[model samples]
Target chain A: MENRTIKMTTPLTKEKIKDLNIGDIIELSGVIYTARDAAHNRIKENYENNRKQPIELEYQIIFYVGPTPAKPGKVIGSAAPTTSARMDKYVEMMLKQGITGMIGKGERADYVAELCREYGACYFLSIGGASAMIANQIKDVEVVAYEDLGTESIKRLKVEDLRLIVGIDSKGRTFQEEQVKKYKISK
Target chain B: MTRIMSTEDLIPVIAKLCMDACYHLSDNVIGALKAAYEKEESPYGRDTLKLLLDNAELASKEEMPVCHDTGMAVVMMEIGEQVSWVGKPLEEAVNDGVRKGYTEGYLRKSVYLDPLNRVNSGDNTPCVLHTEIVTGDKVKITVLPKGGGSENMGTFTNLVPADGVEGVKEFVLKSVLAAGGKACPPIVVGVGIGGTMDKTTLIAKKALLRPIGNRNPNQYYKELEEELLEEINKFGIGPLGMGGRVTALDVHIEYYPCHITSLPVAVNLQCHSVRQATIEL
Candidate 1:
């Protein structure tokens, strides 16, 4: 948990993710893919049925989000992280696909941290409900697949200086668990 | 003498309420967030609170939704007993307003046509509407756009009368802890005590509509609210559960008398982006 912010780019490697610790601040830039519950379900189904996935998952980052419709002249609408815990079941499946990074809000199941350690992946936390501020960091958006899914579609996002905190590191340490214990007062 | 009120007129007003509630968070919420920002002990938690305040300001200035999940429209209407309705059916008119508001306002369409089939309703129609007939000729409507993250974390349980207040407190603390960052803490906890099972959950959600600083009015309940708030903060769940001093902005309890055998309790958690609005005509 370093009190310093580190800058990182997309298509992250396991080596790059290995040293990152829970509670480290990150300024992430470059391409990431957005997928929420519906998109994940479709992705999993496609994998199960041996169909080609819409987006290549290897060495990629997945952000759990379902943004509102963009206004005229806007690239995207209020975009923020949905609860990550809801996507916990899909984590193992996603990690198996060679995903190195996961971003969203909330505390996840314990096994998610273990999976991160097992797969040498990292989980980042974005501030929940800070949609407008977070949306400002997104430079461009393209719906790469599942247009029928609307907001749940898998979109390629180009974000610049997107703020995030490491929720779980590759080592399996979780910031929420450590920090909550620190500040909790005995009854 | 009966006053004729047309349901047709409600569409535009409800539409505006929906947009306004989504775009601009109310003053009470803004104030509470600012206070939470000032008092938050954890640096990470404080920074999160600051971002939330900035997000609210940005969303209002741009006339965009404060959060992406614009939520299912929860409408509470108080209609005058002396009024007679004409024009479209009440439910249809309300859904029309929701559809218009979500579409025109550029908000997300989150509601599904059916739970099992899992098809998007597309227009965000078929709102959850609760109506009550009251004394005046005027009609009052409140639109609360409740996000899914917090709504999904809500809980309900029926306890034996012997369990009493201790049981209620224990249940509430457990619920909040279990919700953790998932419910998006620095949350407003709406606790419903007494009543039947369904009614308890309804009032629990309705309790969130109250101003953050306002107490339950009853001295005993007011004290309980204060106690719960203090205890919750002590849990260190903090903002977004990153951990800090102020886990909850407020605790509101709404209770009703129930049968002798049952003590039912429900808890509804509202995320920091509490968006709601009310109007009277």
Candidate 2:
């Protein structure tokens, strides 16, 4: 792994993401949108509706989190990432909408991993329980849409030094899947 | 005699207990993480361990809670055999403490009153309170804040005696693999074997309170713990399952004799931040 920071745009390319590996530590300095169960469903519904003017999503990263409400003087309260498996069902939908990367904890389902490989996307696992540590990296946050959803509402987060690992790379190689094989010892 | 504790007397103490436990990782847990950091072979796992230590430091300095899930208040009490009181009921006193702790400490209220409705408990109260009467004259209070991620993945199996230790090892590994990164890697696994179904579950949960990295008293159980740890790490679950050899920090097993036909086993997994505290009043 060379010490070169590649400045890539969203709708990430297969060639660019392919170079990433399981141990490659990188700072995600980009526009990552926030969404969880509710927001994922809403986006799916919009696609089904064939809504005339749909939100453009070609190279966006969706962060799986439901942050606590911001205290009066704070930007957010303990904004940690939730378990990623919960969003397995909605990955394909979001990926189709041009989601190139995902940041969350845990592993994706087999189908989700397959879709990620098919679509040239990647999955990055952040440090769980380090919400306050991660929260320090966010430069700003705003509710771009879905204010009614409260904590689950969709928001745009401007972040820096948001450390993450390539849990699943673009070449369809997943550390998570490999882990199962490595550890499942046959009696 | 039914001794009573007033809301004022109980709330502050409970609030302080919660805040203290949330902000600071206990010495035993920290020691385990330190040891895990040293022993972790994967670069990614080592990095994750660094981040964990950093998080703990930041939490202490910034006065921030360790994890977002400060967890539901679980009060384990051993009331004194002698003492009389007048004030609020025990439940009310505990609830008052929960309310103040959550509200004042700025901790998240992660509990839902009704499992079905999913309505917020508001204060994280109506705690999972359990009490026992003992021969002592003082009250012994133990606060164990069980996080949802690990709690969600806990499993219990009532095995047949024929299955033996091998069965216990398989169930624990399977549960850990199934959990993956959900419970937060570098986990502390608690195994309870030989008790009945519910008893085993309790044993597993209580086992978490033991100092991390410390082996069980029984020599057989201690060796089993080492074997299980080696097997779990081989999975390369690493830190947060990013790929490495440090899947679990330690495997702590607590066991008791069971019926001739029953080989009950339970697995209570815990994340890096194993938060717990106790007070003898």
Candidate 3:
């Protein structure tokens, strides 16, 4: 019914992530990592290869995006959010890596929500097709890892007032679960 | 007497049409979004609609394509039965249009030659062109640029006639709900029912070409569209599918009589940036 201003510090921790609720609209501020279908796979592969440690996520929001290459003198191109369901497979990997939140569009699978409950993480929906507008919120951008994937590559971004809505929260509520309850008529 | 359209003459028209559709949301689509926005009870859904409208205006003045996807070019041609092609051939002419439009407008080249290798097709050539012959003196061309996000969520199903209206409604709702925010709601759902498998799918896509807020000409189809729209909005997929009353802006259904045994249905979920324009020559 009402909105309150709060700062979302990146590299977030369990203690910090426990207080958020479902249906909250967050104006996220601080560092976040970007990845999508490909980068998520690569991160999983690094873990599979036992390559030191896969993404040491903490208090971080993973933005699911594969942006177009930046134009001349721009920090990024039209960087819109991709569908999040594609990253459903990597949620466990991310949760184990201690990711506290995610920023993307669309629904996460049921298993992903369970993992969020177990791991004290939350998922939020960023405005789809609003990449250029969202990009204006970014203060800095850098390649965190996996630079070879180009747009799909992992990048660390400094952002402020990046808007998102909680789709799944630590309390274990999800839009999918809610809708399935509302719509499932019978067997 | 057939008139040959020079490639040069056709290219600019296509180029301008493409640019115009990308920056400006068609009036019908705008009307649909506004209606959905006003009816939407969720604050987020309403804000999303405002963002979309604002995006449309900013894209126009700044000349940025509405959504970065820009999409693959789909050309629908109603060629006059009397007309014959000349010059560089029809396909080549269409490609030339894509080349000029994508290059000049600075649209993203999302087309790839090899699906697996992912090689950009340079100029976005080999457009998806669907042609039809109709009794007329003038040629009509309509371009519907389909973005990848929504295109990826399209689904097809073959059903028995026994499934009937309930079957049609179930398939439509399932497809949209499964797509959720992936298709970027509030979406416009295009449902094609009753034709053979392929035609059914084609009809679903063709349904999207119908102007926004326009119901099917068939009275039965019009009723079905209204019912489906109500059911879909009830899902609360909202704008961007984050839970709201405007999951779907409209439902456009096109049906064809089929063999008694078949009830093929296809759901083509078109994202809010439904960019389309037609040229009559």
Decreasing DockQ order of the candidates: 1, 2, 3
Query: Could you give candidate 3's per-residue lDDT for residues B32-112 as a string of tens digits?
Result: 777877887766667888888777766666666677667888888888887766677777778888778877776666677
Off by over 4 Å in 2: A1-23, A41-58, A69-72, A144-150, A178-187, B1-4, B83-85
Clash count per candidate: 0, 5, 6
- TM-score of chain A for the candidates in order shown: 0.98, 0.87, 0.87
Clashes by residue pair, model 2: A10-A59, A11-A59, A183-B235, B3-B85, B4-B85
lDDT of 2 by residue, A1-187 (tens): 3223344444455666877765456677767788877678788888889863134577778888766445567776666777888899888878877788888888778786788779988888788888678878777798887776666678888887688767787777777666545544454
lDDT, candidate 1, A28-111, per-residue tens: 999999999999999999989999999899999999999999999999999999999889999999999999999999999999
Q: What are the per-model DockQ values? A: 0.77, 0.45, 0.34
Q: What is the C-alpha lDDT of each candidate?
A: 0.93, 0.77, 0.78
Question: Which runs in model 1 stand beyond 4 Å of their true positions?
Answer: none
Write the residue-wise lDDT of candidate 1 on B136-249 in tens digits: 798999999989999999999999989989999999999998998899889999999999998899999999999999999999999999999999999988999999998999
Question: Could you give the C-alpha RMSD of every candidate to the true structure, in order shown?
Answer: 0.9, 3.1, 3.0
Provide the TM-score for each candidate, comma-separated. Answer: 0.99, 0.89, 0.89
Docking class of 3: acceptable
Best by TM-score: 1
RMSD of 1: 0.9
